[model samples]
Target chain A: MLSVDIRKTLGAFQLQTAFDAPEGVTVLFGRSGSGKTSVVKSIAGLLTPASGRIALGARTLFDDGSRINVPVHKRRFGYVFQDSRLFPHLSVRDNLCYAARVSDRGGRSPDHVADLLGISHLLDRRTHALSGGEAQRVAIGRALLTEPDMLLMDEPLASLDGPRKAEILPYLEMLRKETGLSILYVTHNMAEVARLATHIVLVEEGRVVRSGAPDDLLTDPDMVRLLGIRDAGAVLSAAVTAAPEDGLSELAISGGRLFLPAVEAPVGATLRVRILAQDVILSTTRPEGMSALNILPVRVLAVRRGDGPGVIVQLQAGHDRLLARITRRSADALGIAEGTECYAVMKSVAVSQTDIAVGLQSGL
Target chain B: MTDWLGPEEWQAVLLSVKVSFWATVLSMPLGLICAMALARGRFLGRDVLNWLVHLPLVLPPVVTGYLLLLSFGRRGPVGSFLYDTFGITLAFQWTGAALAASIMAFPLMVRAMRLAIEAVDPRLEEAAATLGANRVRVFSTVTLPLILPGIIAGAVLAFAKAMGEFGATITFVSNIPGETRTIPSAIYAFLQVPGGESSALRLVAVSVVIAIGALILSEWLSRRVAKRISGA
Candidate 1:
């Protein structure tokens, strides 16, 4: 676990944040200029906080009271920046081995890391010759070869386009699952937060507004304002129950089996599916003869009204939590409130391939 | 090549190459240090140091030579100290000619190297540090290789300038046959006597060839390193 409590003054902005990253993927989620990067830089020792204590596991990395500040190199945390800062002078192979060679400690071989990141063929290529996605992958491989105690990624996928992001997301998921290394990933992308974050730290104006498991924080109606109501959603853990037929695959969730766009995972493979709040429709009674294929019996956990005409309703569906953004008039007519019984209906085609992602493996 | 010129002319050509080679080689380490300091250091007297490094470039070569003669001539403070300590002599010798050439060439060398060092991105060094490299390792692994082409360019420019150095060489070391008579001084000597224009012309041609060759070499070397860096 990495603990961070730092206060810094940059120009007119004041950054005061404190959070703990456990042995899973802890995401620092925030909009730009929110001091998310500052927090990560503080942990990497690239930026010093005015007064704070930062500890990783049993070792103290930084403490202003004790006047102890470890330099960046000795901190031994692999950092991947938003831009792929590969040495233009080195081949992909050399860049991957740079950390290992400089630290004079052998960890994974370059070939092995390249294979894991699907960059084996690019080993001999120069850094400038790589595409954006390929370069980012090589950057990740370079970081991993250090065999660091933890990995720090600051929006590693932000520079890539949609297809490119899709290319690297699976590797990121695999890295966390295979290494089980504590990763502090910083980004503002909602899909990435839903897909990769095992733990979420919502940062606003240089402060941590909330920090908790993705299931709870993502579904919390109060967090919708911070998460951007349009992108706010819930991640439901489910196992593949059947192969694709008619372009839809069946996944067994706690509430019931759900049919979504064809998921590439094999039957019995568990994954997380993100259902946007805007995509869910609430009805007090089960609607008959409807095109929507999913209807789960749920009890209203909370009804939160914003200043706009919409109301965010949090629903408890069996053992999982779901959220629906309904119009104020619809909520009034349906009498949706805490403990109100309803059925959360969702169109089968609303969830796209980007919404389905690999969740944290049990006990990892 | 020897049959094309008289023995004295050939000797002058060889002496010029020798002086310029030593001048460029000897001054490189100091040149690199000064360039890095000027490019990255923020300490006190940095501006003064920058001005001092460029003084020889703007000052009249004769005045710069006089200053060198006063400080480094035999029986002078630094010259005497070296003589008493090591029994080494530089004034009126080939070594003094190399020293004058290097002094005249210092500004060009430092400017080229400084530009190159300034062009390097500090972010790359930070990335290296985050990857477990200390300050020295970051410089050696990332900074040095990136600035190598610039260093080569500086060395070549200094070499060309040293090959053409005349005013300072004459004042500091004076002309001496087979000792300090580099091509430029030899050309002057040939022009002072009747029926010596052909020899001066031959030495001039030799200097031009050497200068052009150095430029070509620098260009090729820089391109090769750049291609390796940018992969283009």
Candidate 2:
């Protein structure tokens, strides 16, 4: 387990956050300047918090009230900065081997990490000559070669384009499945959070406002407001119940069933689907002759006022609550309120296969 | 040109080369240490230390030589201590000429090295620390290699300055034949005579050529080292 409880005051900004993350991918999700990087720095022993303690597994890395602060070199946590920060003086091969050579772990080789990160072909090239995605791969390989107890990645994909991010995501998934290394990933992208995060810690202005499973947290309307409309959504884990004759796939979520456009997963395989808030429409009654394939009976749980003249309705669909944002005028005309029955309509094509990620149970 | 320069001129040229080479070799490490301290070390009276290191650059060379003589001349405190303890003398000696040359070149060396150290990114040091390298190892591995170009540049500047040092050397260690009479002092002595103008002019040309050669060598070394580090 990696546990952090630290408090630091930098000028007017005060950071006091506490969380215990089991050995998997625990993501720190927040907007820019939200002190996520500060927390990572404190864990790496680069920044000394004013008071509190940090522990990795059985080791007490810092306890400021007791005057205990481990030096950075001995912490043994692999840190991958947003910029990749590869040493320009070294080749890709040398960069990967550097930490392993210096680390106390005896005889750890660079070839192991290179193979895991799929960077063997780029080893001999200089770091400056690599593309952005390739540089990030080399950076990941360099970090893993240290044989660290945990990996801390701070927005490693923020600098890449969409194609580059897609190119690297599968490798990250492979790393998550293959290695038993615990990872603490920080990113402002909700898609990345849904794809990689097992446990999510939502940080806002230097404080952790909420923490829970990614599936539950993504559906919360307050989280939607925090994440903004462009990226807000509900993450649902579903098991493929049947591959229907019409080439569509039937998956069972908590309270209802969803039919996606077409899924390649065999029956009984699990997939995660993200239903965007903007793509959902609500009706008081089950309407007939609608082109939308999935419509679930739901009860209005709460209504939240969103920024810029919009209303966010929280609906209890089976055991999960999903958020739908509509204009305030639409909410009033449709009478979206607490304790009202409604049908939540989501188009079949709106269920993006790219949003569907297959999670491995192995701890990362 | 060969006929114009005689055997005495050759001796002065060879002696100057030897003295300047030793002077540069002995003081280069000290220059690096002083530059590091000035650029990165934080402590009380750091500004004073910076000012003291650069004092030789602003002060008259003759005054600096006079101060060295007062402190290191025979019967002077340090000079007498050295003589009594180890039978060594500095006043009017060839070693004294080297000491004068090193002092004159020290400021130039420290300034160049300071700029180089300042150019290195401290973030790289922090990155090294995260990779399990201690402070000393980081310096040897990261800091030293990055600042090597600057160090070479500073050494070359000091060497060129040491080769041409005249006022301080003549003042601290008087013009003694074959011991303290370097190329510049010899040229000065020859110019004072009735028929020694041509020889003095020839020695001046030789000094210019040596300075230019040192500069070109430093430039090539800096480019090579920069390419290696930056991977361009």
Candidate 3:
């Protein structure tokens, strides 16, 4: 477990945050200028806080009361920045082995790391010759070779294009599952939060507003306003039940069988699917759907009204909580309130390929 | 080529090369230290140190030599202390000439190196530190390799400047045939005689070749190092 409670004042921006990260991936989710990066930097010892204590398991990394601020190199925490900070003078292989060579405590070989990141073929190439995605992969590999106590990633995918981001997310997922190293990932992108976050810490204006498992916080109606109502959604864990047919694959969730776009994972593999609140249509009764494929029987858990005409309706479908963004008129007409029964009508095509995350069942 | 010049003229050529070589080689470590301090250090007296390092570039070479004589002469404070403690003297000796040349060349060396150090991204060093590299390791592995081309350029510039050094060398250490007489001093001595024009011309040719050769060599070395660093 990694515990961080730090307070820093940079000009007018005063940041105070406290959070705990267990062995899984804990994502610091916030918009730009929310001080998420500052938290990560403080954890990595890149920026010293004015006051607080930080510790990893039994080791105290920083403490103002004790005046025991461990230096960055001695902390043994791997950090991957937004930009791929590979040394230009070094080949990919040398960059991967840099921390190992310096620390003389390499836990993994360069060849093994390269293979894990799918960069074995590019080891001899110069960093300048690599594509953006490949360079990031090498950067990740470089960090992993150190065998750090924890990994700190500060929006590593923010600089890449869509296709490039798609290319690197799988490697990150694999790292999370295979390494079992506690990771602190920071990003403002909601899609990234839904896909990567096992635990989510919501940061706002240098303060942690709320934090919990992705399933709980994402489905809470009170958090809709903070999570960018349009991007607010719940992550549903399901296992692939059938192979892809007609560009759709069937997955079994606690709610019911969900057919989404062709997920890359094979049958029997569990996956996390992000359902956007805006994409879900709430109906009072199970109406005969003409074209929409999914209509699950649900009971309204809570009704949250935003400043606009839209209201976020939280529903319980079997054991999973789902959110639907419906206007005031629709909510009034459907009589949607706490304990009201409804059917969440969702078109099968609304869920994009990017919304699906291939989660490893056992590791999670 | 061996017999193209007399023994005295050859002595001047060899001695000049020797003085300039010592000047450049001996001053390098200190030059690098001063350059790093000027570029990255944030202590008090940083501005004063910067001004002091550049004083030789702007001051009259004769004045610089005079100051050296007053401060480092045998009877002077540093000079007398060295003589009494270590039994070393630099007055009118060949070593004095090398000292003069190095002082004259120090500014150029420091300037080139400082610019190179400034051009390096500090972020790379921070990344190395986060990757388990201590300060010494970061400097050796990242900072030193990145600034190697600049160091080479600075050394070569100082060498060239030392080779052509005239006013200070002549003022600090008087011309001695086999001891202190460098290429410029030799050319001056040869020109002072009635039938010494040809010898002076030969020495002039030698100085010009050395200066141009140093420039070209520095340029080539810097370009090669830069290319390698950029991964070309």
Maximum-DockQ candidate: 3
User: Each model's C-alpha lDDT?
Assistant: 0.90, 0.86, 0.88
Best of the two (2, 3) by TM-score: 3
Interface RMSD of each: 1.7, 1.7, 1.7
Task: Point to the candidate with the largest TM-score.
Answer: 3
* Clash count of each predicted structure: 0, 2, 0
DockQ value of candidate 3: 0.69
Candidate 1: what lDDT? 0.90
Tens digits of lDDT, candidate 3, A1-364: 9998999998899899998987788999998999998898899888999999999999999999999999999998889999888998888989987867876674788898899999999989989899989999998988888888889999999999999999999888889878888889999899988888888899999999999998999999999888998899888888899988887888887888888876788999988887899999997767783688877899999999878899999999889999999999899987889999878988897765577876556223
Tens-digit lDDT track of model 2 for A1-364 = 9999999998899999998888689999999999999999999998999999999989999997778899999999988888887877788998887888888786457887787778889999998899999999988887887788899999999999998998888788778778767899999998888788889999988899999887678877777768878788777777889987787889888869999856777788777787888878999989799888899999999888855788788888988777787889989998889999999999987776576775433221
**Regions more than 4 Å wrong, model 1:** A358-364, B223-231
In model 3, the runs with Cα more than 4 Å from the true position are A362-364, B224-232
Candidate 3 per-residue lDDT over residues B159-197, each given as its tens digit = 999999988888888898888999899899889999999
Q: State model 3's lDDT.
A: 0.88
For candidate 2, what is the DockQ-based docking class?
medium
lDDT digits (tens) for residues B59-136 of candidate 2: 998999998899899988999999999999989998999999999999989988887788777877887788888999
Tens digit per residue, CA lDDT, model 1, B137-158: 8899899999899899999999
DockQ of each: 0.67, 0.60, 0.69
- Give the RMSD in angstroms, all C-alphas superposed, for model 3: 1.6
